[model samples]
Target: MTQAMSCNEAAGLVRSQGAVVLHTSPTTYDRYVSGPGMCLLDQTTEPAWVRTADSTQCFVGYRCRAIELEIGQ
Candidate 1:
């Protein structure tokens, strides 16, 4: 049986699910120069699990891969 989890709790769940996880900080910021002023973007990279299913919930033995984003142009 699989356990219900929140977005934050899904980090450990993803690992236990035999998925490749990419963990990051809570306050991930990206600063870039857009024309004149600088643009500051804030996001969360704690842990996002992507599985092979369309449903929101996944089984315990499910597989997931954490997504990575590249900053800068």
Candidate 2:
């Protein structure tokens, strides 16, 4: 229900809040974090690339994905 944000704005949220749920689109969202420390024991941090109002491929922060999936890649 909110407007799309800039890369800086999205990156700032992770830096300031440590972890937050970010919505790229009305129906698409994911949990982003400042670092791996914020991820679960069974999860690992991965680069979060998203389209923002100002950039197409913005590196906002990291996303928490399954550790096994990360290793498998």
Q: What is the C-alpha lDDT of each candidate?
A: 0.31, 0.82
Candidate 1 residue lDDT tens string, 6-38: 443444444444333322223331111111111
lDDT for position 47 in model 1: 24
Compared with the true structure, what per-residue lDDT tens digits does model 2 show for residues 1-73?
1137878887888789999888788898888899999988998888888888888888888998886655557
Each candidate: RMSD: 14.1, 3.4
Overlapping backbone residue pairs in candidate 1 total 0
TM-score leader: 2
Candidate 1: which stretches are off by over 4 Å?
A: 1-4, 20-73
Q: Using lDDT as the measure, which candidate wins?
A: 2
Prediction 2 global C-alpha lDDT: 0.82
